[model samples]
Target: MRLSTVILPVRRWSEGGRDQWLRAESLGFHTAYTYDHLSWRSFREKTWFGAVPTLTAAAAVTSRLRLGTLVTSPNFRHPVTLAKELITLDDVSGGRVTLGIGAGGNGFDATTLGQEPWTPRERADHFGEFVPLLDRLLSEDSVSYDGTHYSAVEARNIPGCVQRPRLPFAVAATGPRGLKLAARHGQAWVTTGDPKLFEAGTPEQSLEAIAGQIGKLGAACEEIGRDVEELDKILLTGFTPDRGRPLESLDAFVDFAGRHFVLGITEIVVHAPIADSDFAADEKVFEQIATEGLAQLAG
Candidate 1:
């Protein structure tokens, strides 16, 4: 399995942030992703920068490592504007950009833009409209659309993306509607196990829950006559009950990854060590995992 890291946008680009991206590339990480948010859960009061700008800067500095948002959502983003930014980012990164997108949750991002939180059904509906329009905006030269949640009139992305039709999309979903969207539009599928199991469930239960979710995703793909194996299965670590266990050591991560690999996971994304945070871990160990963990799993 390919190993990646999520570098939270909490540090300023001048101070220690740029170093992290460089280090990730040097360590041979497949991709270095960041949280796309106005403000994330606990990092709300921290120095959270914008995801696009941070990624743009990262693209400038890194040559080999792919850059992406762990998940961008329709929360405070319009498809027209986001497509423009992503097209530019793809150009800047030399076609080394993947978009991890999802139906956003009822977090601080939900109400941050002077709007009420959307219900689950509303979020799903908005996502259905958002992903297709965004896909069109990136692929076609011009787009015009009217829909329940979003409308774009003669929106134009002239030069378009560097990545042929568009950049790859890693759709984050666990629910039926969301999984169907992923199956339809995604180059990859992402999950963080099951949220219900994050706080109280055992590791075994979390594994079972993810297996069930994968089964649903397969069914969703089958409904559309798409082969599920055509999409890469990605597990964004740290949300399952196993939490930091995988990052505890190189051996731990290999074991953790092996378990998921059996479940058809192709990519494993771990957080870049953030001292004293929910994502805190040993930096050396994380680097070891980046460099050697996947090889160990193969062996």
Candidate 2:
């Protein structure tokens, strides 16, 4: 039931965005994550910083607010490189780093730049293979792997990560395979949306869908002989509405978040105002919304 904040796909990073997260730490946020997609949300533009480095910047200034990828693509980088990146960030964050890995979104952002296209099944298989390597690299001095799309030498990760065996790993999943993968391997399961109201659809339908997803995750854990209770479920939602939107007044964003977020796990992560709404105009607006939004969610 812990609350985490996230940066979404259709969002951009501004100086104001950086400040927004800084304020998040003092606001009592447990985790702060960002996307690592190459494709932009609206257009086909690329975001700055591949992913790990941007979090590096987030960790540099904040003493609290755990840093991680909202969901780093399994295909975008190799396991060795990913392990290295997670280790480095863990070092910088004093072991307060989590790694949110996933198959990534399928859009111009992921498949553009002449990258390969993977069937959903392929990505799930790849993720299943990728996760175990993370543990192997972190736990052992040397390792070997021979999988469908991966091959690693008996290479030593050298000194390992700051979090000892490895850092926590989370996943963003909404499909059968993704759900099972998230349940079997991920320390946590995160989804993107607004918890207060169905930012995407009717609230009742969304609630039903969310409850179904959680049930599937629990079933997946059962299939694998793992206890679903051992894992945490987190929803990444922009619960606080714009100042005067229809749901804005009724938003009681905090209470709404509590309602939807508690559907299964009894807790959820609430995202706030976006970073790209009005870059130039909302500089102060970002500060104001983030400050108040933090209090609303935390309180």
Candidate 3:
């Protein structure tokens, strides 16, 4: 299985951000992603940076380390503008960009733009519209569309993306509607286990939940006559009941990864160590995992 890391954009590049990204590349991470948000929870009071700009800087400094947002959402983004930025980012990164997108939750981003948080149904509807429109905006030179939640009138993205039709999309979804969208448009699928199990569920329960979600994803692909294996199944760690267990040691991580790999997971993403934070971990062990975890798993 491929191993990757998520470096939260909570530091200024000159201060320490640049080193984290450079280290990720040197350690052979498959991709180093960041949370795409104006300000994430808890980090709201910290030195959070914008995702695109941070990624652009990272792209300038690193080679062979793919970069992307753990997720970008329609919470405060318009497809037309986002497409333009992504096209440029793809070029900047030399076609090493994957868009991990989702139907945003009712978090700080939901109301930071002076709008009420969307209901579950409304979020689903907006996401359904957003993904397709963004797809067209990136693939075609010009696009014009009208929908309940978004519109694009003669929008132009000339020269398009460096990744053929467009860069790859890693759709983050667990629900039926969202999974259907992922099956239809994604090159990969992402999940952080189940949120309901984050606080009170056991690791075993989390495993079962993820297995069910994968089964649904497979069914969704089958419905469209697409092979489920065509899409990489990625598990972004730290949100499940297992939380930091997988990163406790090389053996712990290998065991954790092996269990999920058996369930058809092709990629596992862990958070880069952050001292005294929710994502806090031993930097040495993290680097070790980055360097040797996959090889050990293979052995």
Candidate 4:
């Protein structure tokens, strides 16, 4: 399985965030990601940077490692605007950008943007239009679309993406509707296991449950006549202390990745520890994890 690291822009100066991602690339990570949130919860009181610019800066600094947002939703972004930004990022990264998208959630982003509270079904409906229109706008020369939530009038995509047929999409999905959407449009499907299970269970249990989610994704693909193996599987953990702490130990991490690899996970994206203070300490801990983790994999 490929391995990735997510260096959050939370509480880090732009330079520190860029440095951490650079460090991740030096340590042999396959891809580097930053969280795409507008003032993430609790951390709202702290410094949080925008995902697009941070990723743009990251692309400028790193040459080999692929860069992207952990997942960007349609919460505060229109597909047309996002498509333009993504193409620019892809060009800057030399065609090394992956778009990780989701149905979005009710968080600080929604409220801050003055968006109405949307039900899960409504979000799914919005995504149904969002993905396809974005795909067309990126791939076609001039497109016109009138959808329920989004619209484009003869949109021009001049000097198209660095990657032909647009950039790769790593769609995040857990529910059936979302899974079907990902199967239809994504190059990869990303999940974080079952939230209920992860909250009350041990690390082993959470990791074990991911296989079930993979199975559900396969079923989703089958219903849509899409080949399951054609899509990459990515897991995003390390948000909670319980989820993040297990990977601190080298052996635990190797086994963690190995177990998911067996379940058909193509990549594991672990988040860097929140840098409330002592950024150096957080960096050191991640350095050890990445160093030993790669060594273990190589062995």
Q: Encode model 4's per-residue lDDT on 159-270: one tens digit a residue.
A: 8899998899999998888888888989999987777765567766776677778888999999989899999999886532246553566767787777677778888777
lDDT of 2: 0.66
- Backbone clash tally for model 2? 3
Cα deviation in Å at residue 226, candidate 2?
A: 2.3
Tell me the spans in candidate 4 whose CA falls farther than 4 Å from its real position.
11-15, 239-242, 277-282
In the range 1-299, model 2's lDDT, one tens digit per residue, is: 46566654342446465676677787666777776776555534533445777788778888878887777777567887777777778888888888877776566554676677777787788877787777687767788888787778886777777776678778777777877877766788876533444444565665666787788888989998999878777765542232223124323545555566567554344444554542123334433444454456556
Task: Write one digit per residue (lDDT tens) for candidate 3, span 1-299.
Answer: 89999999988888999999999999999999999998988888889899999999999999899998889999999999999999999999999999999999999999998999999999999999999999999999999998999999999999999998899999999999999999999999999999999999999999999999999999999999999999999999999999999889999999999999989999999999889898899989998999999999999
Candidate 1 is scored at a TM of 0.99
Per-candidate RMSD, Å:
0.7, 4.4, 0.6, 2.3
Rank list by lDDT: 3, 1, 4, 2
In model 2, which runs have C-alpha deviations exceeding 4 angstroms? Answer: 8-18, 193-200, 238-251, 275-299
Q: Which one wins by lDDT: 3 or 4?
A: 3
For model 2, state the Cα shift of residue 294 in Å. 9.0
Comparing candidate 2 with candidate 4, which one achieves the higher TM-score?
Answer: 4
lDDT string for model 1 (1-299, tens) is 79999999998888999999999999999999999999988887788999999999999999999999989999999999999999999999999999999999999999988899999999999999999999999999989999998999999898999998899999999988899999999999999999999999999999899899899999999999999999999999999999999999999999999999988899999999899899899988888888889888989
State each candidate's clash count: 0, 3, 0, 0
What TM-score should be assigned to candidate 4? 0.92
TM-score (C-alpha, index-matched) for candidate 2:
0.81
Query: Positional deviation of 257 in candidate 4, in angstroms?
Result: 1.4
Residue 155 in candidate 2, Cα distance off native in Å: 2.6
Better of 1 and 2 by TM-score: 1
